[model samples]
Target: MKKLVLWMVMAPVTGLCLSFMYSPSAVNHPSSKTGKLIISFRNSVDALPLELNKTYINSLQEPFKVTRLKYYISHIELDNTSAVITPDANYFLVNEEAPVSKTITVPFPAGSYHRITFLLGVDSLRNVSGAQSGALDPLNGMFWTWNSGYIMAKLEGRSPASSLPLQQFEFHIGGFQGRDNVLKKISLAFPGGKPFVLKAGKTLTIDINANIQKWFQGPRSISIATHPSCTTPGSLAKQIADNYAEMFSIVSVTD
Candidate 1:
């Protein structure tokens, strides 16, 4: 009787240990295990980098004052030689401030990815998908309550061409219908699959350059004098947002 009881107890314990060791969640494969990646937001205006530290604050150009800069990024897709890893509910918000930064844990199948593609702004589906938490939390201050959707992009600052009072430029770009709809897709290729590697406890870093010229590319230049605030989804907002989306480029990647 004593032997039988010991055996019964040991049986489940042994099985549990084996299950943990061989479980899919515990398995670490290049194509199975998930690796972490960090995404950072960099601010630039009129061809100069924006640093929140007081030292470089004075370096900003005359017409390019960096007041507020924010955007939404989600639906991460990683393309490797064998498969494409698309994680569900992957969303992130990028903002600028003192030591401003947002890090995302991009879980991939421990394999090397040759290229990556993502959306610059929230998709129309998730835009109107209603309340969410974490990166999608409305309380994070990224959503527009009056508009009933997310603010696709935000560029705020005071320029000489701007008007009085706030004397700033607020271009909030967002639209889910018609030609005014503006959601851009950005893709970057990693050759030789070098920067896409993942080792235990290692992290990959990618720096993307947001070119200021891209903001003026589509319809017309952002004349703060004429269009100062994007109270809603208007013409100037759409044009500037469209132009700015094209400026996204991968500057550097390190593992």
Candidate 2:
């Protein structure tokens, strides 16, 4: 009777110990606050889905028709109170003119985090690092082989809304060296939650709004006169990319 009781008590505890030893939490020793993160997308200025507005043809002065829109984001970080949860670079990419859904696991020191800070696009390190997968996948069409980098932002459309015909614009904004670097880092805060609690094995879905009209919001409709594509280094791409960086905002989170 004594041996049986001891076995019952030790079996579960022993299994749990071994599980923790091999878990990802063991590498960083995450606290009880650890949880999974869910991210979603929205377009704020206009209800237009980000997917529909990502192409340059979509940016013409008038007669806007969207044939296609796509891009990629890599090396993301989620900022919290006690620690920053940065996932592997193999994570997300915005493609096929569709808003994407992804779950990223961030290991923190264990505590509630009310807000998060992240990148609107990939960091310079991965942009310069050679070939990659997912968002970095060369097959995704966001990368530029001749220039040796990624197209940080892409928009296309045509409308009875503009004056130009067959207008298309492509903005590939990134250059680690010199006047065209377009990586954007953003921080968002949440109120009313004290040390936000993340229970183990649970997932939180967060909604992010990428304002589609943000590119043309402050400025007049992009002149159809500007260069059609960023085949060479110049200001057209830089201006549009800078505009695209300002398009993101946080909408909500579901735990």
Could you tell me every candidate's TM-score relative to the true structure? 0.73, 0.68
RMSD of each: 5.3, 7.0
Q: Which residue ranges in model 1 land beyond 4 Å of their true spot?
A: 1-32, 52-62, 80-89, 98-100, 191-195, 199-201, 217-219
- Alpha carbon deviation, residue 166, candidate 2 (Å): 3.3
Candidate 1 lDDT: 0.64
The C-alpha local distance difference test score for the whole of candidate 2 amounts to: 0.57
Q: In candidate 1, which residue pairs clash?
A: 30-111, 214-243
Specify the highest-lDDT model's number. Answer: 1
Off by over 4 Å in 2: 1-33, 50-63, 80-91, 96-110, 159-165, 191-195, 218-221, 225-228, 231-233
Among these predictions, the greatest TM-score belongs to 1
- lDDT by residue (tens digit), candidate 1, 1-255: 999999999999999999988876633334435456666656664357765321122112235465677777776666632222333346777777534444555655455666677787778777767777776688867688987777877766666666758666667777755776777777777644465675545666667766654554444565556667775776766777767867776766777
Alpha carbon lDDT at 168, candidate 2 = 55
